[model samples]
Target: MALPDLARRAASRPRLPSLASQRRVSLCETLDRVLNKGAVVAGDIVISVAGVDLLYVGLNLVVTSVETMRNWKPAGTPVRQPEPLSQEIRP
Candidate 1:
């Protein structure tokens, strides 16, 4: 078949229905998925002037859950403990 005929036939055909689910996800679930499975990007930026390197910047970004952030601790750093609530009555 000619290219124009083939194009016309294809255009005349009905489009297939979308495969996506009709249900809507809640805000909490969306937030959980985004924070827990988000991508981490680490890179650097370099600026050159007249063929000479002028400036360089390093960037490291992480998007994660609050629990993950709380559990993360730097090497050799002491872990902090939450202070107990005072039982004394205030006047």
Candidate 2:
């Protein structure tokens, strides 16, 4: 009884495209699409001591091609670069 139920569940699961049925994408094409559409890589890092988070670091990165940036803004909009995130610590 258990085995038959498990089989039925497996058969009902969604399946991905078969290898032959899917089109092959080159590295260049993949990179181009990602840059044009924009990709955000975000993560959080924690340095802890004895399960206590002593330091926490957040990271966010956006990677895009220069060509994509050229057309990123509206026709009448100005292009302004963002300020740097780092601050100089004067001791």
Candidate 3:
């Protein structure tokens, strides 16, 4: 077929519906999926510049539910509160 005929056929075809016109997800559902069932990423980053190693970084990430965070506490360590800012005296 000629180029003009191909272009005409393509233009006449129906367009697919956009995602906005489809189903909508609620904020609570999105948060639940992200915070509760999210993926955990554990990796390291190495930077090299001018044929020499410059910086090495270790990255560990954990994504969990709010309940897990609330119930988590360090072993054999007590939670300490910071002193009030007003109690500090400066000469």
Candidate 4:
């Protein structure tokens, strides 16, 4: 079979934003977001020998700043909201 036209194929695809157009994120911002929202990593490891399972291990980890952890609340608990700057507004 004849080779497909490379230029024609590429032209059909949509163009992505150039580097200049994309927003740049700083390391501090990335860490702040991660700590603010927290991240959970969970996984399972299994070791087998000759089709027989020999060992199974599971791991779960949560990464966040101390302040973030302190603010965490269990399910069904009413969240406390900060008072609005304008006291005139009421629920």
Candidate 5:
């Protein structure tokens, strides 16, 4: 019996980036450049319900910091997957 070449096997394996060497950022902010904070216009199509007419709507999204997210999880606790439902199928 012949043994497999260990050097060739190791070379074929993929190398992953080190977790410690990765960029550590407490918070990352991404701002909208096209229109940082402004209002948008919509086509003229007015419809009234009861007695009020719909005009316009705008939304702003804000992301929380990394430290706030990490604190949410309990320390040294394992996540358990929910068990599948037990049901009988009709033929």
Candidate 6:
């Protein structure tokens, strides 16, 4: 009974596509849709008249990704540039 159940379980398990195939499918389905389309947001800015006065009463914050977070660095910090190779020297 145990052997038959094990074989049945192995046979019934769904076959998964390879990682490369999965990546291709994901790119085709979601990434392509987002890249090749524009998203338009239509909504009301003010829910109520009372909310206008409450807007500035709380903290105002901006969120960004790690790659873009460096742009917010304070002034005076030296940004390091990569050294050029010897072959790129000008005459």
By lDDT, the best candidate is 2
Output the TM-score of candidate 4. 0.19
Q: Please give the clash total of every predicted structure, in order.
A: 0, 0, 0, 0, 0, 0
In order, candidate lDDTs are 0.33, 0.35, 0.33, 0.32, 0.29, 0.33
Tens-digit lDDT track for model 4 on 30-90? 4345444454443455432331111111001112232243367567875443222122435
| CA error at residue 76 for candidate 2, angstroms | 54
**Prediction 2 TM-score vs. true:** 0.19
- RMSD of every prediction: 24.9, 23.4, 25.6, 21.8, 23.6, 20.4
Pairs that collide in candidate 3 are none
lDDT of 1 by residue, 1-91 (tens): 3433432322232232352543333333333454445554434554323311111110011112322444776678754532221223569
TM-score of each: 0.23, 0.19, 0.23, 0.19, 0.20, 0.16
Per-residue CA lDDT of model 3 for 1-91, tens digit only, reads 3433432322232233454554433333343454446555444554323311111110001112322433564677553332231223579
Model 4 is weakest, by summed lDDT over 10 consecutive residues, at 52-61
The digit string of per-residue lDDT tens for model 2 on 1-91 reads 5433432332232233453654433333433454444544344554323411111110011122322554587688775543222233579
lDDT of 6 by residue, 2-45 (tens): 43343233223223366554322322233235434465443586
Residue-wise lDDT of candidate 5 within 8-81, one digit each (tens)? Answer: 22223223345354432221111233234345444566432331111111111112222233345667764332
